[model samples]
Target: MHPDGSIQAESNSSKADRALFNSSEARRARLLPSAEKKKRRMPRKGKGRREMAGSRHPLIEAVDPLAEIFYRPRTVTVMTVGLCLLAWFSDAFGLYGTKFSAENGVKRGLWALIGTFLAYSALYAPHTFMIRPHPIVWRIVHGVTILYMLFLVLVLFLDADQARHAFKYLYPDLGVALDERAYGNDCRVFTPENTSSRFANIMDTVLDEFVLAHLLGWVAKALIFRDWKILLFLSIGFELMELTFAHMLPNFNECWWDSWILDVLLCNNIGMLIGLFAIQRREKYGNEWVGVSSQPTILLKAKRLFLQFTPETVERYEWKMMSSPKRFIQCMTLAAACLACEVNAFFMKFVLWIPPRNMLNTYRLFVFFLMVIPAVNEYYYFVTKTGKEQVNKLGVFTWIFLSCTFLEFLIIFKFGRELFREPWPPLVKWSWMAAGASTTVALLIWTVSRRNKLKTQ
Candidate 1:
């Protein structure tokens, strides 16, 4: 009986040991999956390390910032709203009565508030609507061009005095701001005796505000055409334009030296060379030549920030307008469009009584500069592409550009009826000049094509 009891006790101990072993095994089985999961989650070497680092560091993915900015656009939008609110409060209420007279303060405050809101709206409107930055700029540019067209259209319905009232509404001191200085003052006919005075006056004109405007205008033309020949043609054409319209617009009158030397040589020629040089440099160096974004340095970031004001893209334009008759026709159309734009610049100033230094004139110039970038791209596509692939319709910006040009002409006709009462003769002259210019351009293009073919032969 004692032997039996000893065997039973041993069996019981064995059973307890088995039970402990089973429980431990079950616990390990439950923990095994978790351990494996941790193993899988841990980052590995090489690619995995890079990915992990990128996920942790925002700057690592700075190359594609638009994507990141887009993903968390709500945060950006909220921040903009908060800052605008702060500005409004600070301007309107915080310093309203203390720093300025109540009426003046409130006026300034409202301007600040509204301006801030508009500016923010302009910046984020594209983001909210799911468009890219360059496209956003395109849209803004087209919008401004269209706005100007509509404004001019509105002005077309108003008489001269009513237009003056319109200007007064925008600026109360419009009359006082208007420069009543007559053009061609003290009309100095070219004489050898008065050569010194004439030279002095021409030199003075060379360095005046209009010189910068002329230079910039030529620069814009250079960027548009990217051809020295076409730039030369346009430069000569503008001098002809000034001569053509001088009888109607008194301001178009200029000395021979002023037109050929001061304008064509000093301003237009120099400006075109500078602009073309920039284009060449851009081509040689590529878009990332500055390496501003790639450097990941504070100085580079600041440089890139400043460069945002420059062209978003700079592509080398090889105009093959001489390739076909259709292309030649398109080029002539472009010349006409360019001439019309130049005419509009002068007429708008004359009609609106806006000086060179006026805010309105500056704003118009800025908007036009911005507008042409996209418009020219779209126009080039329309001109180059053929048949099924060609864009048959004008893009929004291009349409706006043409419309604005037409409206400017309409404005001049409507407002300057007295000034242009004898427009028939000038109109006839312009038509003849335009025909001659087109013929000259076509001949030049044909000559270039013939030379190219000969080289190929």
Candidate 2:
């Protein structure tokens, strides 16, 4: 009986040992390899994890280059080329009959073509070369353009007839008829009783003309920044700018409710917001700008097909959000540009005696639209890209600016003959001019200072 009891205890001990061995083997199997080995196994995942850990956010994947070509820069190029082609064909076909004599026609066409070629070469040819200079040259070019525009404006005041004649020679079909008798009292004078009508007219002008212009501006901003915040800030800042300059331009001065509540906060601000929203939605949803055959409904598919005909290409601008100082300066410069453009438009019209819907006005506006794309693109590349500055000034802008300034001068000299006859209050005129210059300088200095501070930080 004692022998049997000792054998049973040994058998139980053996069973316990086997169970312990199995438990230890299970724990060994569950143990993980070192992190280094894991990283080696999944290199991409490891890199992604490291990036996320180091940065504030994960990096976005690169967008396709083809998708980006549809946006502003390329579209503008396509449009300009199309226009030039159309103009060439139209000239060949006599679609718009030439108003000039045969000898004049040949001379004018040759000169205009030469001028355009020179302008185009100056603006675009530098980029082809391997070495790029700093943007200071481009800025100088822009300054020249501005000076030329001023010259055009001066010419308008000095001799409207000469300005008109020049246009006639350059673009005979679209030439201005200098005979005031032929135009026949087109300029409608405003009166106290007609104030309401004038105001309504201005409102219509803002909506029909300026709204579209502003929308285009938003599109330009979108193409440059690619981010919503910058667009919104710029749009808002512009309205403030108009307000600041209101005292100088009667057209700018408006009812408080109209200027602030409606114009600034509502129309301009809402337009900007809408543009930003569209950009964000496009980014977030991913622009699957494909064909509409996959649409659930035939009607929807048909609508999509129509849209495809008017397809707008999306160019995703890769943006690195600028520091506050840089942003402020950029916004201020943009506002100044806008103001200068507006002033040019008004002064040109006023001095030239050209009605709003006249061919001259239309041509000016169209030419400006064409010029802005290259100018903005060159400006952006200079501002953001490293070691790329020697972009040339767009020929159209330079020409327009010079021509407009000359026209303005002609008008001032011609019409203001009686107004300046007495030389009344030279001090006041000097003071006003001095103030404008000072303001411009101050804004520029502030911008540079802020940029420098941001760089140091």
Candidate 3:
């Protein structure tokens, strides 16, 4: 017998007593909420935010219980509510517009930007209630992407002038603005005098808006393709693409030096190198997937928040290049898709007649850039991981992106009938160049793969 008048166990382990105590504790823990179970000791007066495990401030404590139900931070909920109120009050106060006059460029641009922001912000509500469980911003971004794709679909039906009118209707400033400077301005045409001024011409071209635009395009392409060889092929292919379509699109016609040296060699290669370097840096350090949810530090959380604007992962893509018939098909398809994307860029500008600097153009380009990150990931999976029929099921974003690409072509074809009046010989020649270039690159990659395999063996 124990001093407390309880029966003492005979065995040294006291197994029965231990089990009874554990069961009682377990029952108690089960009855209590997690917060109560691991309740933190309150800080005494004069203490300034002392270290305490699992301790939250009274404000945080009150908010967290409610936040758990919504799967969002209290701050996000509060900001969303505040922003909604602000937008509503602003509209009521006639801040966005005094009247519904379509001619007012300021009103139109303001309303468009405000409306888009509000619509995108409103997406958080549905995301909270209906969308799959994810970070609120992530879900909102996905919603915005869907809406953007739908917008592209709607645009596909509108004729060229109608589309320009649509842009003007949205923002009166965005009339069919085109920079009409002759691309082939030098009539001497590669004369010794002209050739002597090549270096000066290169310098002048470097400062040109179009040159910078070309570089920017290559940057996006490099990030998407993630292969120097592939990007090089694309750079040359796009120059040929420009030459092929120059008759239809006046902007495509540039001097030979401008096409090969300035655009392709200088701007495109530099942009690709920059993009590749950025990617390499990301891979070198950012591969360790520290889930945003698990991070507790404020700085890390902020970093994670910024990263929502970028891809979640940065992996080096390896193309199998002719490893098998399926892979060969995928390689060809990738090249074709890239070429289509390039063509879509130019035609979108041409068909819409929106200057590169126009806000509408900028917005579309920015959104499309965001769209491509997901599309590239999905395309890679479809091409490499999945079987034949299985590859048919594309990710949501990829499907929308492909639809947009096709619609862009459709819009160009339907509205720009006069543009398509170019002779078939050029198209045939362009097709052959595309095929030859892609084949040569594919074979080079195949050779590299085979050599590497032989070395491994």
Candidate 4:
């Protein structure tokens, strides 16, 4: 067993292992439940984490448990041959430079692009991050991350107008100028004299389409943090962030009740409750993975199959804010990163002239949700690791997330300058500067105090 409660299975060497090739996702079947009460340990356990029995890539040496038969080494022979045949046929027919209707060409190009991405996902995509449900799912996610990064790079080359115009190739309806400021700037409270009408207006604002999005987003945040304390910190901190940036981003201009009551009280609380419920339920499982073929009943088989979508093992978190100086910094950094991601979501749509309902925004947020599953797990691994583990580098998902965030900032900076040219309000500017300085000074003071206490001990 690895130190973090995950089991590693050997290749098909033993008689038991032949019926099981289930090491892909840090999960193993209870194949030999009858063997002994005390299980045998890996020979390499004493060698430490530094000498993990794999190449530079973490899973390069591990085999997929889902696939039954495979070649000695991984190869894309099928894709190579198919590509060559298509090339030869297109060359012979002189269709390489052929042009068709914009509609037909775009449709075919989009299909081809999807096919290419699938092929890449299957054959060449990195599968080093998430391995739950299946490795292939995470491989597809990695491919999407790469594609999104390349897209940002491509968009960066075009001017704001040119970039927005290019959306016509895919999203033809987005040719119009952006209309920012989703909610109106009416920050009025419930008037006691006119309670009935004001209550209806508040309900209308609270029950909009975006409310569902907020609920789901907070659910994801709850899953990432798991700890209620951290979740509460992030939930409250994000609203404060929206307050700080309300002057700049008009959508951030929400009523006091909308920000504190509806968002923090309603959506955030409910989402965290749901997500934390899931975590609690997951912790109750005994980590017993019986093979599908061994199931006795059809209903049980369906249940197991559906449960495959869940995690192989539940990892508990202890993200207390005042744990240690390093722990405090890590927790705050994670909260800051989550808040930055939230801000960037709205900021990107406004700057790129993309409508709030655009599929681009939806897919971006969905991919981010998928990416964070592994990113949080990876970050948790980094945080809980001891000196014996020697985990000096960030995992693949965290790197992908950080890279995408940087690219997002680049895109916003490149394009937003042309759109939002107004100066920041003086109060907003001074408040942000003071907040930054105070946070820095407080952190330094806390760290020094902790260091002195440790020395006295």
lDDT of each: 0.61, 0.46, 0.61, 0.69
Compared with the true structure, what per-residue lDDT tens digits does model 2 show for residues 396-435? 3434443554454455556545433344246656766897
Number of clashes found in candidate 1: 0
Worst 10 residues of 4 by lDDT: 24-33
Residues 18-70, candidate 1: write the lDDT tens digits. Answer: 34422323323322346554566656666566543322122111223323333
**Highest-scoring model, TM-score:** 4
| Residue 83 of model 1, lDDT score | 78
What's the TM for model 1?
0.66
TM-score of model 4 (CA atoms): 0.80
Model 3, residue 387: distance off in Å is 7.9
lDDT of 3 by residue, 228-259 (tens): 76777778888888777777777777788888
Model 1, 441: alpha-carbon shift in Å?
Answer: 14
- Higher lDDT: candidate 1 or 4? 4
Better of 1 and 2 by TM-score: 1
**Number of clashes recorded per candidate:** 0, 43, 0, 0
lDDT comparing candidate 2 with the true structure = 0.46
Mark the regions of model 3 whose C-alpha exceeds 4 Å error after superposition. 1-134, 176-179, 187-200, 286-313, 386-392, 425-457
> Which residue pairs show backbone clashes in model 3?
none
Candidate 4 ranges beyond 4 A from true positions: 1-114, 181-184, 189-198
